[model samples]
Target: MAVVDVALAGRSYRVRVGAGLLDVAHCEAHAFIEPYGMRSIPIVADANAKRLLGERLQASFRSAGHAIDWYEVTPGEGSKSWAELERLTDWLLTRGITRSDHVFALGGGVVGDLVGFACAILKRGCGFVQLPTTLLAQVDSSVGGKTAINASAGKNLIGAFHQPSLVLADTSCLATLPPREMRAGLAEVFKYGLLGDAEFFARVDESSEAILACDDGVLETTIAHCVGMKARIVAEDERETKDARALLNLGHTFGHALEAETGFGDRLLHGEAVALGMVLAARFSARRDLISLADAENVADALARAGLPTEISALGLDCDGAALADHMRHDKKAGGGTIPFILLRKLGEAYVARDVSLADVAAFMDEQLQAH
Candidate 1:
């Protein structure tokens, strides 16, 4: 088992990563909850995760004489909405969960975001634990404090930065993840390298197949590497006030718009949209002369080789560039009416480019669409 500690002022936590960490979580939870007088825990899990390993987790807890009140939601982006939030909060309140008790998010990113946000606003802020089951959640949202629900206007427009009390990422849990989701999560792993670590990216890109094949050593190393990078960034800029944390949103500006355009449905998963958005950002960088065209193609090729989307042409959205750009206005990065996009100066370096005009983005997207 590998343990990485996120040292945040006033709120530090450990991110435990390894195979078969799920059983360990049960033991730890028993120690924490039993003496604390919290006999039952409200576990908000997604359908898929529950079907796969829910019984095992529950049985482990049950063996220790812990009661689990399981609340399940259907998987996917659609679950992150105002209606679901309201329902979950109401259910949790009915279960008598207070700030003193901890709520558990035991699924992928959607469940983490939803449960975290619910805990954030519930009773003026309750504590929650993250049990990230999918690869995307393990690598990205589970460790970050950025909890949110989708608004009608955009993706993640409404959110709060409420750090989790604990994060348990079991690589073994990823065995149950669908192929598409596994590939989508790899896009985020690619983001870590593209944004900051050239050497790491090179090694992973060279070993893409082995990593995709779920080699335990490579999988653990890849997840730990991404988590390490994120832990440092979050420590430096937990709220993204500095440019350090914002760099994490390497392709989010365009990607969120793509998600909104698709109504946050199965048409485009968050990681898939992000993979496509990274290509767009890379191309836009090339257009701005910040990076060479060959560099942009290289980024696109790496994403494609990982079985992720790298183009906007195949999405077949009926919207135009102007419409796509309009959705970006509601982005969390938009401040003072000027949107900031994370563009790369080179393969391993990224900086916030806020001066890029929306008209320009729309036009470039149109060009990309027409080309396809």
Candidate 2:
């Protein structure tokens, strides 16, 4: 129902957000899918998404005379690996996928990242479309050009800057998501408000219940707003050459470490880790007098009310601050021994903080660990 454009000259694309957008036409599918004029479409999805949306999507595309060659991976962050990438590419090659064809990634962030990266390196470079099924993917990762697979050293350390040819965020697909996954997606939605719009945060705070319930209007507006903001930043600094796009990694520096420590499993979903990380970042900001304690508590409360973790201690991991901070040292944001954290100045005002000492981060994590 709404479109957000990421104008980057040659690489420009649009993010379409709406309920049942997978079947939408005129502005999107008509141009992208119709022009291919092929009977088959190459699609990659996680097991869960493929099971849930595969039949419906296949039927829709088939009705348009386009058959889908479905490729599936096990659904999880673990699928973002070298082995999976190699397996996926080999499958594509066996199927005769070429640079002239468009690949469709039809799942959450994991599927999007994996397929996007595969497309980026497949035959040097190929175009891909993102049919993101999760809220986290729709509002964040699906829009950004950051395609990656996890490395042994850390998460997202190996990848490329391949942008999607188109992003179709069908809110209808979200209806099949479990409560935990839905709540996790809400964390990224919350991040959009936290990082930019004070009024949006207030609206989200007031409408948390309705939003979680997936009211169509709320979902559309919420995802569209976040996508629009990201479109602006991606257009301004597509490669993160400046600090403009860096602000998008609001809690990622802390969150990625949590992900690495947990072995990137169901123990902590990426969005849940981001929820905890945002709280940590907020609390750390408050400790530095960058923001008030009240504001930080508000951030924690918002995420907690959405059924997300707000404290590292709650996970009961057998690790300490030193251990967690050590994992952070592998974060891509760090440079020359300094880790640049996305910290808040206030509710809706985030900045990159390069002055944070790892020792202090460890101490803070220690305090959090000991608190509960």
Candidate 3:
């Protein structure tokens, strides 16, 4: 088992990453949840996750003499809406969840985000535990306190910074994840390396096959490394006060725009969008003479080899560059009417470019849209 501590001032927490950490026979898993000390614990999961792993998870908790009050939400980005938030908050209120009691979020990013936001506002903020079942959640979203839902303006536009009390990333649950989701999750896994760690990026580039195959050792090590990197960044910039935390959004600026264009649904998973977004960021960096064209191509090749779309042309969108760049104008990172781009200085080095012109981004999008 590997443990990474997110040392936020006066609000620190632990992210435990390992296989079978949520299994019934895992004594450590039991010990971790046992401390919450609730007889009837409230857990929120997506309908798909509940159907797949809910029985096993419930059994694990039941053995310890606890009953689970499970609440199920539809899977996907749509659940992160005002209506769903209202429903979840109402349910938590009916369960009599106090700030001291922890609500277990037992699914992927959607569940984690929705539940975390609900807990944040419930009775002036309550505690919650993240039992992330998806690879994306375990590696990135689950560790950060950036809980949010999409709004009419942009993705994660309506949200809060409420950290979880504990995050138990049981890699075993990933075994049940669909292949597409697993691939989508890889985009985030690679982002950690592309942002700060060149050595880690090299590892992913070399072992992309082993990772896609779910080699146990590779998977565990990869997840722990990503979590550790994220934990450190979150601890350093808990509220995005500095550029450090924003660095974590390496591919998000463009990725979120793609999501909005695709209607934030099954058409383009968040991670898949990020994969293409990162490729675009790399290529755009090269265009600005920040990095070599070979390096940008290498980034695109790595992701494309892993079955992610690296070209905007592949999306078959009906819109053009100006249309796509229009979506970015509403990005949450935009300030004073200027949208910042997370461009690559080189492979494994990303920086925020607040001075980027939206017109330049539009021209770049036009070029990518026509790329072969």
The models' CA-based lDDT, in order, is 0.89, 0.88, 0.87
Model 2 regions lying over 4 Å from their true place: 25-27, 34-39
Whole-model lDDT for model 3 versus the true structure? 0.87
* Collision count for each candidate, in order: 0, 0, 0
Off by over 4 Å in 1: 35-38
Candidate with the greatest lDDT versus the true structure: 1
For each candidate, give its TM-score against the true structure.
0.98, 0.97, 0.96
RMSD each, Å:
1.2, 1.5, 1.7
Local accuracy of candidate 2 as per-residue lDDT tens digits, 92-191: 8887777877888999999999999999999999888999999899999999789999989999999999998899899888888998998998888888
Q: Write the per-residue lDDT of candidate 3 for residues 1-372, one digit (tens) a residue.
A: 888899988888888888877764224445445655755778899898889888888888888787789999999999999999999999989877777788889899999999999999999999888989898999999887999988987799999999998888888888888889999999999999999998899898788788778776888899999999988888888888778889988888888889998999999999999999899899889999999999999999889888988988989988888888998888877778777788888788888888888899899999888889
Q: Candidate 3 has what TM-score?
A: 0.96
lDDT of 1 by residue, 275-339 (tens): 99899999999999999999999999988888998878898889899999999888878888798
